[model samples]
Target: MLVGLRAMLCIVSIVAALPAHAGTLAFPSTGSMPVLSFSATVSAGRDTAPGTALSQAFGNAGLAVSGTDCTITQDISVNGTLVPGYTNVYQTGVPGIGVRFYITAGWNGGWTDASSSQFNKTDGGTAHYTRADLVVTGPVGGGTTSNLPSMFIKFTGSCIETVTATQTLTGSTSVTGNGCSLTTPTLAFTLPRAFSKNLPSIGATTGDTTLSLGLNCPAGVKVGITVTDAVNPANRSSSLSLAPGSSAAGVGVQIVNGATLVSFGPDSAVAGTVNQWIAGTSAGGAMQVPLTARYVRTSSKLVPGSVNGKATFTMSYQ
Candidate 1:
């Protein structure tokens, strides 16, 4: 009896010491439904090179991920209220939208396909399992009409079974170079006041500016950057845009995304869905992300008063 007790104690201790596979879900604002917590981790790419933002880096490197394994111990259903006609959805492998949930191999799980499907009841049929990912989709507005924030409380899709097990990451959780801040509080890109005068002709660009993003984080961690600032969110084109006030006329500004002009807003492409990053070196280095800023000439009715705008930014890491 004594020998048997000793063996049992050793086994229990071993399981207790293993890293836990647990995580959380975050909703941006109030009115969000209480989401069941899930395991979280950086992008699987992080498992590869430590600081390098793979070709999939959205902006900088750090992308917020729950983890490789996510389990929903309960049976729940949801649909979105952010917009009408387009809600309650999920898809496979980071499609830039939807709840993105799947089940994995484990005890007691049998799931139904979540493709374009809505759940109005406890998972019908036998219990199944799949790998899952609930991603941040763009809020509705301008050129985008999918996966609104309301999906948080109103989302319905694939589900995971609850089980007691250990799933430690084979990847190096060593994260570094993770602190990010805007070094340049303000950047003024130049658009010729005369360009406003051009009115519809689209005058030449007056000047340009680059905002610098400084990073310092755990060595192996990855980082990504996103621009949520735009004067007029409703007028976005996968980029940033300046809103048009009654006081100002004939011209609006647009932020440059690479060679193309992208509008600004929560739904714009400037959102941190792109997989790009400020990579770290083998020695756990640092990085500076440069954001290009310029003015796109919109409307021919150039009103040369005070041309001003602002945008807020955020950084994510895995």
Candidate 2:
């Protein structure tokens, strides 16, 4: 009688351990969901328009939808509000930027907008629900974010969802901001006519002229400047090449910022470019930069005629 009672208790315990309701929805039996990652570059700071796609990745490719009489429904909810005119798009931590996860029913089925947090039929069966695409959009922000919880899905029915790694949304974006507005007059220099004997040797310099640059900047921005040789964009040397139409030969122009001789670089605002220097931090007011330009002999002989050189100034801010 004791053995029979013990056997009955063991059967009851086994039945209790079984799942009461099996889910019909299913994911992949092996492997894991793919990670969605992105890298983007934004010029002129948040200059990109909102909703512009930056990067994309496809996930869940190996996890085909399969189940007996699969009539499952999946509801979607994102961490942020939905963007208008965009399906399944949600805002990120940064302003003016958004992301989306577009899911499909597999086969030739169309993509479904999962943004509504409503359970919709998976249309499972031989359709083989295949994959989803993740997209990042603008206006992009600066810096990086990892493992962002962008989306969550809930399904109804018996499903075999795999125990997989986190479906993290990783992003890195670079942006440059508008620093200051600049104004400067066209600079010109006239040197007294000198005899070749007086301008004796090569490397001799003459024709010093003062230049002033006016800047209207916002407060707290650290401003830097670069001079680009108009004649040769790649020139990073102290000597600026003479532009065409100049009859002069064997002489080049040079600029001195305050007292330090200034070299030229590409006409770009990228930080750390060759010869870029911090001018000062702005106090949200008008500022002036004092500069000087002079001519230097490039060769042994100085041709008598015209001397002309052009340069463009670019500003960078931190």
Candidate 3:
């Protein structure tokens, strides 16, 4: 009787263990999901003239758009297979991704317009203006046990808008002497390193450190200047006297070294006719002169300290 009872108790114990093993077969599998994130920026190509609209003002300045508008996406997956001897199974989920863009616009007082005669009118040109916008989208996310997850339907691409302009001049003048001269001048400008925020190489150490001026003039006239840094040879030129009707003039500057060229202060020029036109009623008429400048840097090493530079202009008639 004792042996039979002991056998029955063993069988009961076996039945309990079978239920525990069967419960393991019903365990659920693991899973994973993808992740996603997004940003944008706006840039201008150059300075604009005053009175121009925001959209039309871009080309006036040399500011250009740089960078993209988008977001990030991530995803993950889990495998259901487990070792026969192990009871615990681990799983993960997919990640998400996305992107967007933004733009900023403003004035940069770093340019000027100078003419030869005071009677000739001068108009204050526009400062720099920039524009940026944002775009957002969703991307595909997927992964598996045998393959690494990938952004299957990723969002990507870019768009560009160019800026442009046209300028005109008009007026009349009178000359008491043989030669007549007019000067229409404005201030020169300087830009800080912060203006070039998008370019990584254009940091505090190697920022755009130089400004240039382009002067356009008529034949026989002379244009000269005194600068803190060495000016480009091509920028210096001869100025011309206004004919009885109208004429055009131009000049320019190229900033050198580690420093940048700022705007020109108030300036003027002298005018007198030479041998032939002395006693005649030589009416000096209306003329237009345009001046423009830009910033650039050399490929030399950036020093660890700050420095200073300057430029001055003076004109006289013979």
lDDT of each: 0.36, 0.60, 0.23
- Decreasing lDDT order of the candidates: 2, 1, 3
* C-alpha lDDT of residue 315 in model 1: 51
Q: Model 2: which ten-residue window has the lowest total lDDT?
A: 126-135
What would the TM-score be for candidate 2 when compared with the true structure? 0.48
- Top TM-score model: 2
lDDT of 2 by residue, 45-82 (tens): 23333444555555653434443334445555656565
Error of 1 at 69 (Å): 37
Candidates 1 and 3 compared: the better one by TM-score is 1
Query: Which residues of candidate 2, in runs, are more than 4 Å off?
Result: 1-178, 189-198
Clash counts for all predictions: 75, 10, 82
The better-scoring model by lDDT among 1 and 3 is 1
Model 3: lDDT to the true structure: 0.23
Return whichever of 1 and 2 wins on lDDT: 2
Q: Please report how far candidate 2 places residue 83 from its true position, in Å.
A: 18
